[model samples]
Target: MATYRPRVLIGNWKEDACLEEERLRDFMHKRERGELLIQKIDKLQDNLLKKIKLSVTKDGFVHFGDTVMLLNPDNKSSVENNPGECSRLTLAVNLDDISIHSAISLQAPCGVSATKSVEPMARNTFCILSVDGGAVDEPIRFGQNFCLGTTGGFSDQMLYLASDHKSFIRSAKKSYLQQVFLTDKLSYLTCWRATFLDPQLRLEYEGFPVPANSKIIITHCHTNRGLAVPGNFWVRSYFGKEYEVVCHTYLDSHRAEEDKNYWVIVTANPSNENGTMLDRPSPYPGETTKNEFHEET
Candidate 1:
C-alpha cells in the first residue's frame, strides 16, 4: 500500500518579513476605515460645529470644542532646528472629548502630528473643500474630499462641500509616499490647501490674504512628523506681485498662564523671480534660482 502525503512549504525570512509588513499595513488601513465610518455616522447624527466651540485662552492655548490644548514653548535647540522659534508646538488635548464619542477630537488637529500616543484616541480627521476662485461676490461652486483609507499609511481625505445640512462628502484619498515614509510636508500642504485656498470656508484671522488670480504654494524642509514648522507660503498675485508668508505655531511664554497658541506671520523677500523656492535646494539637476519671497515666522 502506498500513501501520498503533501508537505507544508515554509516561507523564508524575506518572505516572512514581507508578510509581516503587509499584515501591519492591512491592520492600519482597516483601523483608519473603521474610524472614518464612525466619523461619518457622527456627522449624520449631530452638528459637530454646533456641539463644539473654539476659543483662545488668555495665556495662548487653544480651546477647541470641549478640549483644551496646552501649548508648550519650544526651546532654543528646537528653534534652531526650525526656521523660527515655537516651530514645534506641543499640544495636549483634554481627554473629555473622547468620552462623548465625538469626532471633533479626531479632526481638529487635522494635519498636525501628535507628539505622543493617547489611549483610545484616533488620529485627526480631515476633509478638503475646493471652491471656484471666482470673484468674491460671485456664487462659488465647491467640492470636498475625506480620508477613506491610506496607501502605506499616508492618505489625505479630500471632501467636497455638499448643499445639505451636513455638507461634506468623503470623495477621495490623496496618497503621497513621502508624507508616509519621509516627512509631514505634504500633510501641512494638505491642511493649508483646505484652510487657505478654499474659497467656501474661511479660517480665523480672515485666513491668509489670498488674492484672486494668484497661486499659493507651501514649501518646507523634510521632517519626520508634525508640521514643517515655520512653513513657507509663496503667494503670487495676478499683477506680478509676489509675497512670501511664514507660518509657524508657538506657545507664548509670556502668556503661558493663559495656555495660548499663536501663529506668527511675517512677509519677506521672494527667493526667486518665479516665486517658487523650496526650503531645501532643488534635488534635481539643472535647476535655476528665480525671484522668490522669504518669510519668517
Candidate 2:
C-alpha cells in the first residue's frame, strides 16, 4: 500500500473562519428582529379584529361594543371615564386584510403578510372597528353624548331615511325646501332638513333641476345621525367648454332640531367667476330662497 501524505491547511484559514462566523451571526440577529416585529404586528391586528356592530336609528345612537352612545343631543364630556377604555374604543378601517398603517406608509413592511401580494384592486371593501386611539380622530361629542353621526362611517352617504310609510312629509308652505337652486361648474351647493315623525324619520333635499343623463346618488343618510346627498351636474358654457359640478348635502340629527334643519353647501368653479355670474334658470314664480322654519315633533 502507498503511504498518503497529510493535507496542509490553506493560508489564513483562521481569519476566514472568523469572517464566516461573523456573517452568520449578523444574519441570525436580523432574522430575530424580523420575527419579533411580525409577532407584535400579529398581536395588534388580532386584537382589533373583534366584531363591533351598530344598529341604525333616527336619533343617532350607536353601540360601542355593548355600550350605547348617542350621536345627537349629546351632553357627555368624555366618551369613557377611564382613559385606557377610551383609548381602546378608537375607530379604524382595514381593507383587504392590509393594515392601515402599512397602506399609509410603504416603507415599513412590519404589518404585511408574506403570502399577500401588494397590488391595487378595482374595488375594495373595508372592515371598520375600534382600535387604539393613537391615530384616529377624537370621537365627536355633542352635549354629554358621543356623536357617532360623523364617526363610525355613519355619515349621510351610507345612511338614509326610508322612502316608504311616509317617513317624511312636505312642510305646509313652499320655501327653500321646494325652490330650485343654481350653482357654477366645478362648484357644489347643498341643503337638507331632518325630521322625526314619532316612529318615522324624514329627510328632504332641496330640489334643483339636473341635466339630462346626469346621475343622482345618495352618498350618506341616517335617521339618527346625519344625511349626505351627492349628485353630479353637467354644464356647458357659452364658449362650449364642458364642465361638471358636484353637490353634497348633509343633515345631522344630533345637531338638527325642529326649526333648525341641518344644511351644508359646497361650491367649486373652473371659470374662476363669481357665483352670481353663473347662468342658471330663474326660479319658478312665487318661489323664495329663504328657508321657512317649522316645528316638528
Candidate 3:
C-alpha cells in the first residue's frame, strides 16, 4: 500500500484489485479526526469534581469531556443537605451486601457484543476507594437513550459509561450504575435512558438537538431502573465523607422517582467557555477509526 499510487493502473486484467486500491487511496485521504485536550492524561484523581462549585451554565449546554457533576436536584429526601457539599456519583458499593459481590462475579456477561472481545470484566468495586474519591462524567440527552459508568471507578476517566445489572438472575427488576470509559463498541449494557423536558416531546424530538443545562435521565435503555443516588446512604471514606451512589429503580411508582434520576451536565471549566450544545451527542454509526473523543479545550 505504501508504494501504491492513486489512479495509476500499470497493468490490465486487474478488476477487483484496482477497485480495492482506489478504496484504500480514498480511505487514506478521507479520514477525519479531531483532537481535544481535556486534561493531563496522568493527572491525579484527587476528587477534583467535588471541588467544583455547583453553579448553572451560561450557554446551558454540555460537551464531551466538560467536567460535570451529576446532581440529583431533588431535595425531597429527609437527609440534611450541607451548603457546600456536592454528592456526586462514586464507585463505593455496600461492602456488606454479599449480593453485589456475587453480582460482580456475573458481570462477564454484561456489555457482551459481537465485535467486542469476550473477556471477564469485573465490577470497578474496591473497598479502599473512597465514596467521593473520583469518577468519570457520564453522557445524557433528554428523551434519548444512553449509558453511564459505575461499580469501581474507571481508571481511564474518559467517555461513555458502564453499569452492573445487579440481581438480573435473582430479581425481576434490574438495577445498574453508569461508569465512564473509552470504547469503540456500543451495546445495551452502556445504553441509559435520558428523558427530560416532556415525554410527549420525544415523539416529535427525534434528531432534535438538546441544549446543555437541561435536566436529563441516566438509565439503561432496556431496563425499568435508572441511575439514582441513595440520599441517605452515606459512607465514611478516606476523604472526610461521601454519598453512596446506587442504581436502583423506585419500587413504588416509577414516575414518582423521576426526581431521583435527574442529572445536569455542568461546565468542568467555566473560565472562558461553558460546555456546549452537546448534552445529547452520539458518534458516527459504524465508526472504527478511534471513536474515543474529549473536549478540545
Please list the C-alpha lDDT of all candidates, in the order they appear.
0.25, 0.23, 0.37
Predictions ranked by TM-score, top down? 3, 2, 1
lDDT of 2 at 48: 34
Best by TM-score: 3
RMSD (CA, Å), each prediction: 19.6, 22.5, 20.3
**Per-model TM-score on C-alpha atoms:** 0.20, 0.21, 0.43
Residues 84-163 of candidate 1: C-alpha lDDT, one tens digit per residue: 43332322111123323554323322222222211111221121122222332221111111111111111343221111
Local accuracy of candidate 3 as per-residue lDDT tens digits, 1-297: 334443455544265477778987766654432111112211122222213222334454443233334445533451355444443332321222222233212122222110111111122211111112223232233445533333223343322344544553432121234322223344655565455434444566544434554455555555556666555545443233445455565533323344455554433334424332233243454552231111121
Which residues of candidate 1, in runs, are more than 4 Å off? 1-122, 131-292, 295-297
Give the per-residue lDDT of model 2 (tens digit) for 51-124.
32322222222122212211111112222332222211111122222333242221111110011111111111
**Alpha-carbon deviation at 237 in model 3, angstroms:** 2.5
Q: In model 3, where is the ten-residue run with the lowest total lDDT? A: 112-121
